[model samples]
Target: MAIRLDFQTEKKQGSLLITEESESNKTDVIRGFFSLFGFEKEPMQTTVYSPEIVVHSQGKAEEIQKQVSEAINQRLQQLESRPSKDEVEIKKPELINSKRTLNPTIGEMIGGAPQQEAPPEEPEWYQTGIKNKEGVPHYKLRYWCKNPQCRDRSNDYIKEDQKTVKCRKCGQKLLVRQAADEHMKRDEWGNFFIADKLAP
Candidate 1:
């Protein structure tokens, strides 16, 4: 059986017509050809006309129609070269064990398995709380000499109040009252510790 196909190209659109033939099944062949070249197939029939399949093409009609015609000719040649169903032999595929195959279960294939999560990070020692020599949590109090010209204005951590507080650099006397005014304050992260209040 032979199949007859016709096509026309216009300015903005292109169309293909498959003439009806009772000897062969042209619908499948036309559909496959249209799909291979990205064309849309539409069914059309009228009382006065024979049944036919129509496919519309987009883009440059001349170029698209030429390509579609070439593809259809090639497909028809291939179909002609293929052996008839009665002259061909069929073989069943060999079966393998489920374990040997890498096919995972539906649950695993769809990402249903729980993955190992990373451990939660621990806060740094300084951030948790300031510790004394005995490993007990304590507030850190800092003081500095008030004499501006003494060059001993650097801060010193005073853990306890003593009768005499003096700057180690210049032997200048430091008052506990002034130390209270220069106490270091820290934020939740403990990154910034400054006098009076936490750094902005």
Candidate 2:
């Protein structure tokens, strides 16, 4: 039986339509062709607007049509060459009865039994210091007022020189120091002065 194939090659609205003399009987074959060519399984009904196949480009439409024609020709040739149903003998598939054995799991292969977990080690001295929730250590230097009367103390993260800090009681500018032992020379006026140390 002859098959009629229609195609629309418009840039925006392109489609290919396939119609056979016995399309109702050859539904499976048509579905297979659509699947083989990566087309939608649902067939578009013949109408004033809709076409059989909708392609993205003109080249694709033409290529699909050519392929479909070739496939149909091949199918027809195969059908013609095949023996009649009465003359052909069908063999039933033989059933094999076998037990499916699963391979040994990783634990089974290693020791066969679950081992007890060891206790976690204690944290080191440095690790146990002042740290954030994420276990990151924060080292803050101590900053205190030099005035004995106003023995106010504060903690800061930065280590810059001459960092001015206001005392709560005296409200005087207190210079920051890395260590308590940092020497400060006293002038004749009794004012303490820090000598500038040159880089060696």
lDDT of 1: 0.45
Model 2: weakest 10-residue lDDT segment is 191-200
lDDT of 2 by residue, 166-187 (tens): 5555665655443424444323
lDDT (Cα, tens digit) per residue for candidate 1, span 114-184: 78899877645444334465764444334345566654444333344333456666666644432223444
TM-score, prediction 2: 0.20
lDDT of 2: 0.45
| CA RMSD of each candidate after superposition | 17.1, 20.8
What TM-score goes with each of the models?
0.22, 0.20
Clashing pairs in 1: none
